[model samples]
Target chain A: MSSALRIAAVAALLSLAAAPAAQAHRAWLLPGSTVLSGAEPWVTVDGAISNTLFYADHQPMRLDGLKAIGPDGTEVPLQNASTGKYRSTFDVKLAQPGTYKIVTATDMTMASYKIGGETKRWRGAAADVATAIPKDATDVQVSRNVRRIETFVTSGAPSTGALKPTGKGLELEPITHPNDLVASEKGRFRLLLDGKPAAGVEVEVVLGGVRYRAKGPELKIMTGGDGVFEVAWPEAGMYWIEAGVRGAPNGSAPAQNAAYIATVEVLPD
Target chain B: MRILKFSGLALAASGAAASPTVGQAADLTVSVEIPKLNVAEYHRPYVALWIEKPDQTAVRTLAVWYDTKLKANEGATWLKDMRTWWRRAGRSLNLPADGVSGPTKAPGRHVVSFSGGQLAGLAPGDYALSVEAAREVGGREVLRVPFSWPPRGAKTATATGSTELGAVSVTVKP
Candidate 1:
């Protein structure tokens, strides 16, 4: 199939998967901090598949395209990478603070071949334009569910200038400084659709890795009438705030589910 | 055995790291309840206890109970199941992390304290005491209780799990 045709096919498959009945799960890469101060400061990160965010114990699945970005904007590998029952765990030392981001991608693309009698999931960033449908292939389907998680870290006080959305999907453009968060502190965050405050979206903050609902401490509230949501910090440390909206299948635009996941850090004082 | 020395995470404190003298005298005690489930095969759950600042930076590790008797730290393979702590501070540490790593506890309430190096030089600020438990062929649960450094009066919080653990609690006394 041609590149343009493959792209069209993928869009069609994505729209089919966007039905309200389909499960819209999210994948996230959460870091302990976006900003690291003082001597020998380090941050640990957890990655998993859960639409609720920060709650790794819920449907914890491995994340694809996991990598750390150094202050210089380069891909850095994690040491002692391991997967447990809940999520994949790894740690990175913020030797130079700045804006270190932890990023991960989830494969939401679906490719179904009729002849195989088995549905094969395809990644949006993988080889889509090259492979041809195998012989006896009666039908082929493709869709997109790519999610991105971005966390930041700085040496001193965090800077809002550098912490902007990567324009990939839905994002939480935090009006509140993420690094200087305190336990039980009330914070304000704006849900951004295309660099604007998205309205009436649902947002949640999970205190720890929880597998069951109402098991651990978590706060779930819909974004206020506007796109901004007021979060009462449930007790700092590492927390994931996730919120998103469903972009209806528009003309030529597939039904896209944009999920915004941001790992925020709150300080002790 | 690394012999309970203050290094890496222990010695490395944040800018908030203050002299223990000025930080109110406080004590932290964490208790984990290992549930005894009547299953076909049962193995003790690996548990990790540690404290983190609002930034989720590990301040101190109270305990990491695993199969310490294995030859050449063989039990370390499954340590990652306790995802939160292993990612926050466990990997940087070698087993027999003296004062930290120990053998798994049977179904009972096990307690450990934050004192000596663990208590001293603790910066006064809001922090969370996180306790995580994961058992093989079972479920995983993580409990986090928010408290202040140099604890004032007495602060306590508890989290109960269905499979791997029962009621996990944390208490800090003035």
Candidate 2:
């Protein structure tokens, strides 16, 4: 093969090797400490999309969609938020003595349509579809993407006031308080989709520190009929849980794909 | 009608008086030992004692020893250092709890006794007494002693910790 063709062939092989790793990149928000005591204790959190859990070696997770819900259910602003090359770091001053929910949710609409004899793609919010896609376009296919990444931090006592679900996308209704997890004890939670129980969904649970182990100790669990699932932690550390579901297209509405990811800390008994 | 009402009131009063002494009272005594270390800077460890069911759910908190006298209750700040108890029960408890919270103790064996009246609502079952201690600039340790409720007989269970805590024991008497 010619030099240019040989280079193209090698690039194709390299891209093939990198495809799976890119698809496996997990996004997480890791707090320095999940449970805290004291008056107005501050917690630092790092956001990243990386292959190794909790370790920021890949692309930084953007903070534009990040929000912190205070103990009072009010939106609290993140302090000293900065986005570095590999991660995003922010601080939260827990003035209230209850649990706070930090979340980053992104919603987008992906569309592919044929213009004359050519195909074009557009990605944006659902509201922009009318203007972004011409009326003459044919064979238009649209899909909605919703991703929610979250973690909890408690200052003093943990409370559930901030844990109420938004009735949109995939969310966790924690029967077992997230910050109160202990090793060897069962942690119970319910999954919800669009304000209703999301039953029979597959949930993935993996403890952090995957870099030290030869194999990723990932646990697969299915939500029961009532959408509740129990996880008996093998040991104490940070754990990442993810669940996703796809909705069938209905009438004129686009097919929806939603995913919920949470990072929880489990203490040794 | 007056006579019937009077008799009914009298019967209810007698029934209330008879309940406390109905059965054998269950008394529990826990002894916690805070080991003295040779470190240059030593601070009395904050300790917490609580009862948990076989499923590890905290039934009741027996005692919490910490620096309760700090101005503005600032000493409660480090209460999370006793992490296990804090997550299990302490976080939910209001500090300065009557009869349950006290000041930190010096290095030595401290024994606390709970009468049947204090343990009144605890159901009859197998339970464990968990003792956790954390010190400033020092380590933390937890020791659990298992025992059954409404003692079958005079029973004593003990556990030892290498650092931050010494020998801990729980005693139950019928």
Candidate 3:
């Protein structure tokens, strides 16, 4: 091996020994309650990006442009992005006795890397191989990850139709209402791009900390000509559905990619 | 949680109770083939099979085979390896569930059937029949056969997994 190759091998060995334990990044949506008693009921939501079932040891995430969709079809602004020692908290008030949705989203993030003398910025599929950059050339690598979180709270008769796609970004519209999800019940959804079925989309569902691949119960599948897909909802809690689309490359560096995420809660019937 | 977990079975049982002699032929049949592979550690796999809606909701669980014979159901500890299935519906199910649960099968083809009571109240719609397998010290794989509900005449779909499992097929009466 050449001197550069030897150095790179040594660095790989060192990283294997010194790197932190591998953990998947997850956005948790913790709502105060799913069902309310009477009159106006408000839910306190604690949202954070972290590892494990619940804990905030990771970096705080900036949930850009937060809003709450009330049952009455009015969009209310959520308040407080309080960054805690381990997590962040936000609050939303449900003025009516129906299901309310609190959502926050971030844009697609791309990072530029300076390796050796060449500067390279890759997005979409190219980012998957960015690690191939040799240590000698690994001067600096920057990464920005896009993420979104959503939670549903209900006050009285659980409502639906509040989650329609807004004709923007990669989104999933559940034919099966979020509030009505239960075990042994059908959970259906359609992938939409600009209000229609989103064509040629890739999806990743994280369950029990394990992300679904091309097969399995939550089989990684692409929408057919109809832009509809289904997953076998095995167990229930908060399931993070990650969807991404890669548009045409803007000059061969990498295709401009966009991602959509929603954490839907399924209650025990 | 327990009530909702067993309601599927309960619904089936009630349907059977209502008409003892109806004896509806199983409308759907799931065929899963396990390939014998040359691996260092070759323990049988714990597999989970179910049907889901277009939204990917698990509408019904046909069967789950894991380390059920262990004294304390210790084999279940590894069920999480089935990843996608565990998160979608496995974790909530009580072990040793009467008709919907069983023990893991050796390398071969296995069939799990669903009848009238078992499939009580399933509405006609687009659905996917999914199967996943995870083994001890072995790899994991998942297969999905997307098919419509209440088969118009006879409908079937099949998919082959790359590892752990072989060909998986779903068949429903037309």
TM-score of chain A of 2: 0.91
Best by lDDT: 2
lDDT of candidate 3 vs native? 0.66
DockQ of each: 0.03, 0.52, 0.02
Model 1, total clashes: 11
- DockQ of predicted candidate 1: 0.03
- Rank list by lDDT: 2, 3, 1
Q: Write the per-residue lDDT of candidate 1 for residues B4-61, one digit (tens) a residue.
A: 2333245334313333433334678887888778999888899988889988889877
Ten-residue stretch with the least lDDT total in model 1 chain A: A121-130
The candidates' interface RMSDs, in order, read 11.9, 1.4, 15.0
- Alpha-carbon deviation at B13 in model 2, angstroms: 25
**Residue B27 in model 1: lDDT:** 74
Model 2 C-alpha lDDT per residue in residues A116-155, reported as the tens digit of each score:
9987878899999879999999988777888899999999
lDDT of 3 by residue, A27-141 (tens): 6676755654333445677766676543566755455566788887789667665867667777776666567777776554344557666666544433454565445654343
Error of 3 at B20 (Å): 39
Docking class of 2: medium
- C-alpha positional error of residue A91 in candidate 1 after TM-score superposition, expressed in Å: 2.9
Candidate 1 structure quality by residue, lDDT tens digits, A103-218:
66453543455665754444443345226446566545444454556666654334454455666666766766665566656788877766666788888776645555466576
lDDT (0 to 1) per candidate = 0.66, 0.87, 0.66
**Tens digits of per-residue lDDT for model 3, B34-140:** 99989887899989998888777788777888878876555655665676676567655555666777888999998866765576566768889889888888878
